[model samples]
Target: MAEIQAKDSGGKGGKPKAKKHSTKIDMTPMVDLGFLLLTFFVMTTTLAKPQTMEINMPVKAKDQEEQSQLKASNALTILMGENNKVFWYAGLPDAPAAPGVQVTDYSANGIRKVLLARRSNKDLMVLIKPMEKGTYKNMVDILDEMNITGIGKYAIIDVDPRDEELVKKVQ
Candidate 1:
């Protein structure tokens, strides 16, 4: 909305000239429209949902020696190394008849395939041991793979010297 007003100059015994006018505009409508748009956007937009990782916490035991252990046949140890290298084996690394560590990548056909093949074994347990020099991303990728393969029984264990020796042998 605009309002116009005229300015009058004193006429002193001479012919009057054209009067000058000035325009004043009201910006209330524009301000109202701006607020309306802000409110609309605030009401219609959605906030992102937070992502989460599901973990099962172990229960406490009074005596450390009373813990139950998984059998070697059902245990699978996965070692996470640099360059996305994965070394896995069933049973302890130093045990007799235990298969030597084998190298594989983090692809669907690699670790995922191995996990899937052993998923049917009810007591199958996976122990992830990330190398000291390994990237945190390698650990995360294997954990994601563990979830994807639906392996419920799994643990993140410290790297054993024997396993580290095998890791060095692989590279």
Candidate 2:
């Protein structure tokens, strides 16, 4: 019968011991990977431009009394249809005829004129009441124009007073 003998330690009076198991993980590679992912997200993620004015949207109300009070002074009511057409009405609603009442192709020129004229008074306000199917791009464009024209005073309104549900949903 063959007999197996254990290897002796270099100096100690004991058998050779197994190597100690390593539990340490290299964090450098993982940290590099995390930084790379963070950089990629920072490069690719789109940051939306913030709104200039604080819009106070009216709550869903059945009565017209609440709706009537929403129309304040220096309000510029802009009507946008599903077809991308923009119509603007300037000044108080009680005014028989809005001097700038016209359905025109969406452009900054017309908006600029109205806004500049209104900007004469620091307390002037402009209200935009777009339709339900109005594109967000259109709204953003209008907002951009307003910001560019230095008309910081404005509010968003519901074009259709009957559709309180839609207004609430959009708001």
Candidate 3:
């Protein structure tokens, strides 16, 4: 709705004055149209699907002896430490003649490269162990790396005492 109000001013000193008008615009329709468009868009638009990574964890064995043992040759153990430091070693940490522990980071050239290099081996298994001082983000980054490298067999595990010793020696 709109309206115009006119004011007529009589002549001053025998001269006629022009009429002045003020216009008022109603915004009800504009508001209604805005709401209608909002509702239409809200009803018509589709929400985006959440981005997520799928993980499959192994079932636990009831008996201690029933648990399957991972082969030393097929294993790559990654230890997450404070300050974004990452330590890795092949095979069991306590194995006789265990491979020397090496330090790396979460960068594309660091752990990602190591995982990519070992991705050719179908039997490759990765054990991710987060230390006491490691951040939750560190775990997430390692998991992301696993996904990026397409490493199929991996586990988030507790750090063993021997593994801690190895990491301590490295630090």
> Evaluated with TM-score, which candidate comes out highest?
1
Please write out the lDDT profile of model 3 over residues 60-85, one tens digit for every residue. Answer: 77777976788888999999999999
Model 2, position 94: C-alpha lDDT score = 53
Candidate topping lDDT: 3
Using lDDT as the measure, name the better of candidate 1 and candidate 3: 3
Clashing pairs in 3: none
The per-prediction CA RMSD against the true structure, in angstroms, equals: 2.3, 11.8, 3.0
Question: What TM-score does each of the candidates earn?
Answer: 0.85, 0.47, 0.83
lDDT of 3: 0.90
lDDT of each: 0.87, 0.64, 0.90
lDDT (C-alpha) at residue 5 in model 3 = 87
Q: Output the lDDT of residue 44, model 2.
A: 98
Ranking of candidates on lDDT, top first: 3, 1, 2
Off by over 4 Å in 3: 3-24, 46-49
lDDT (0-100) at residue 131 of candidate 1? 86
In TM-score terms, candidate 2 sits at: 0.47
How far in Å is the alpha carbon of 115 misplaced in model 2? 1.9
User: Residue by residue across 34-71, what tens digits does model 1's lDDT show?
Assistant: 99999999999998989878898888788799888667
